[model samples]
Target: MRVLAFLDGTLADPDQAHLRVDDLSVLRGDGVFETILVTDGRPRELGPHLDRLARSAAMLDLPEPDRAAWERVVQLVIDNWSGGSEIALKLVYTRGVEGDPNATPTAFALGMEIDEKVKRARAEGIAAVTLERGIGTDLMERAPWLLLGAKSLSYAVNMAAVREAARRGASDVIFTATDGSVLEGPTSAVILVRGRTLYTPPPTIGILPGTTQGDVFRAAERAGWQTVVESFPASELTSADAVFLASSVRKVTRVHTLDGQPLADSTELHAELAKVYDSQYD
Candidate 1:
């Protein structure tokens, strides 16, 4: 439970909150966030995470973040925290207090110990269920304000999806478009492996671009694997040699079952991919 926070250039106790009541992020979920994995007090793929945060902020019409300030604050938190070998570093930026049109965006960085559950999932694998997101693939382009491509604080829906999966006796969820196109996981990017080809959904179809997935694909490419960005139906998942949900904090987690049906047990592929993942971070 060790936690530390840097709020608006000042270090603060995370237990003792400092956010205002009128902050739009609290009131309307108008904000963007990034969660990076910190190993031995160093954040992995930091630049890409910050780049995504800036892009998300832009989508929300919030002012650009002070990247240097965020980097310094994150490093400071990592240095001062007493967490274990790995930590989850989260950066958040809000639209600020309501009614104060010129109010500065409320930004903060929080660091905490990584969850044991996340580690276990990577080690043992998980089962998922496909759920319809009830939106068309091109809806984001037609309705830009829906904030589909942005990783905003409005995660209640995603949280609900995971809960629904749990109630159905599953550990996670893979959301599909109304037309049954596999989009992504609730909180991670979905990657399907077939033989030597790795497939992932493209961002243009309204999925959040994943920094961890990009790193993994690049590493896989160097290891003689082909990377392709494309969308396929949910049924395609069960046919793949292996399936995984990748994110900065969780790293890589294999999916062994979807809707209680067994998927291809590609332990060999998983081990090979794990080698690539470890080599980069280690």
Candidate 2:
């Protein structure tokens, strides 16, 4: 991974920086971030990415970085290219050091070569299990201070679940409420397909609204495909005309199995939807 750390208006290497854990971003996880897929050497759905980033920043009540400045940094990182069409560009902003010593959180963009495994999973559908419990809404509401829908540095819990899913022989996990309503995955947004229509858990479900989902759904409409936002139980998913997960990285992948049960076939839909999506973004 090649890094260009943006610290107080200067770009430096992470190893050379005096970054510490005391920063509020580190101490309290007070920050917002985004993972964007670089297409044609550019960030796909950049507008939506910025929109979500701003919304996340507002939710966290953290200092907001100028979009133009940040966008330049990303472009610089790409122009300084080390030669990988598939690059994972991540922007992390924090409130700086927590204590007096390392007080200000230094923001930097760390870029890495996209993993071949993730690419393969996009081409080949993944097997996943439905999580029995979705994240609590009360924490996000009552504690309005909580990260909630914001993509913050506090991702330990989410990463843990994804790791566990891999350990269990699945590519990812789809979160669901105790009542069986599906939500989202650890890193990707959830999108379920039925016939030519596409459905996903609404943002109101306490899931991070997905940019990729928005892109495809709009593309689906342009391509004459049906798209809807509504609630459905896990049992209904078992009977879905087609079930798949969508994200910028994974694109559109049909979910073939869940909890030892073979899921329905949505390969043709996946292909058609993939065309509409990939034509614009991938």
Instruction: Judging by TM-score against the true structure, name the best candidate.
Output: 1
In the range 1-282, model 2's lDDT, one tens digit per residue, is: 665646334556645745665667767767778877787687888789888887887887666667887788777777765757766778888777665664444576766777887878777778988775545533446665655577777888778888878787787888877567787887887787777788887776577889989998999999998889987777777888778787767767778887667888777777778899888854
Write one digit per residue (lDDT tens) for candidate 1, span 197-272.
Answer: 9999998888899899999999999999999999888989989999999988888889998999989997778878
Instruction: Give the per-residue Cα lDDT of candidate 1 at 136.
Output: 88
lDDT scores of the candidates, listed in order:
0.89, 0.75
Q: How high is each candidate's TM-score?
A: 0.97, 0.90
lDDT (Cα, 0-100) at 100 in candidate 1: 99
Clashes by residue pair, model 2: 22-98, 23-96, 23-97, 23-98, 96-104, 96-105, 97-102, 97-103, 97-104, 97-105
- Model 1, residue 278: what's the lDDT? 70
Task: Point to the candidate with the largest lDDT.
Answer: 1
Off by over 4 Å in 2: 5-10, 14-18, 100-105, 134-143
